[model samples]
Target: MRILGVDPGSRITGYGVIELADTKPRYVASGCIRTRNDALEQRLAQIYAGLSELIGQHRPEVVAVERVFMSKNADSALKLGQARGAAIVCVANHGLAMEEYAPRQIKQAVTGQGGADKIQVQHMVTAVLGLNATPQEDAADALAAALTYAYSRSGLVAAGSVSSKRKSSSWRHFTP
Candidate 1:
């Protein structure tokens, strides 16, 4: 199954795609969507359009996003929520399955600890996915989220299966 993990930010949203098969994860793609320092709504539109294009191109079986965590600045947190809201709208429009994982869950799944720092998480992500080099911080975080989802539900995803929307059925029934 191909899982698209999103790390939404107002200025730079990161996305990573990982295919899980035979209990292993292979990195498909990972990158950041950078938006100009324009108005908040404009930035949101950029995110929405970029994510929509990415979804169309990747056709992921599911999308997993990092749930919001509290920040020192309320305004920053609000902006993050708006950015995530845009991403969620795009995913829902595609009729794709969506899930959220807390930051600690993502870190623990990838690095075996909830309190692992960014560098540790980045190193573990590259090592686990066999990436050629450490991905950018945001991109690494995105990949970590993808790996977390994939590992947590390894039993449900099938390698070389076709992905389709059908009557609610076991994930094993869908070929992704």
Candidate 2:
């Protein structure tokens, strides 16, 4: 199955695409949709349009999005929520099944620790996907979200074997 994972932000929304073949996740593409410092409505429209175009191009079987986490700054959180909502609406409009995963859940799935930092997540994602170089921060986060969905669907997360399974250089070698 092809999965599209999203890490939404008001200024820049990241997206990654991966395909699961025989329970192994293969990287397809990843990038960010950066919006100009414009009106809030304009930014939201840009996000929706960008995601819609990406969905059409990729035609993923499912979409996984990171849920908005509470922030100390209410305004920041509200903006993130709006961005996330735009992403969700884009996925829904594409008629694809959508799954929401928390930030901690995504980190745990990728790095075997809920509190893993961005660098750790990036390293793990690169190792699991066998990328030549590390992806950008937001792109790596998006890829982590995709990896989370892949692991969850394969029951590795539920079995509590992500740490062991991720030791492999590639998901192709992941037994679970």
Candidate 3:
């Protein structure tokens, strides 16, 4: 299965593509869609159009988005929500399933700790995907989100685990 992970932001939305096969996840492509700060409408349009093109190019089975948390800036949070909504609409328009994962959940799923910092997440993402170098920070975060979704769906199976049943499946229901 091919999965697209999204980290939505008004000015810069990060995206990563990963292919899941035989209990392993591999990186395919990753990048960010950046928009100018001056034009809100144009920025939203750019995000939507860029995402649509990405979906067409990757043809992912599903899209996993990082859920929004309460931001200190209500304005920033609202803008992020708009960007996220646009991303979701693009996914639905492409007829793909959508899933939202909390930032903490994604961190824990990938790094085994909810409080993992961006650098820690990046290192783990690099190691997990066998990347020669760490991806761009935003792109790496998106990739982490994708891998997190794959592992979470597979019963929290850690990399290189040979067990039939992995960690407890309790987190499945908690996923949105």
Q: In TM-score terms, which candidate is top?
A: 2
Top candidate on lDDT is 2
True lDDT of residue 147, candidate 1: 85
- lDDT against true structure, model 3: 0.83
Instruction: Indicate the TM-score of model 1.
Output: 0.87
Ranked candidates (lDDT, high to low): 2, 1, 3
Between 1 and 2, whose lDDT is larger? Answer: 2
**Residue 34 of model 2: what lDDT?**
98
Q: Stretches of candidate 1 above 4 Å error?
A: 155-176
Better TM-score candidate (2, 3): 2
Stretches off by above 4 angstroms in model 3 are 157-176
Residue runs of model 2 more than 4 Å from their true location after superposition:
159-176
- Please provide, for model 3 over 59-96, each residue's C-alpha lDDT reduced to its tens digit, 9 standing for 90 to 100: 99878888888999999999999998888777766767
lDDT of 3 at 1: 95
Tens digit of lDDT per residue, candidate 2, span 30-99? 9999999999889999999999999999999888899899999999999999999889777766767777
Alpha-carbon local distance difference test for all models: 0.85, 0.86, 0.83
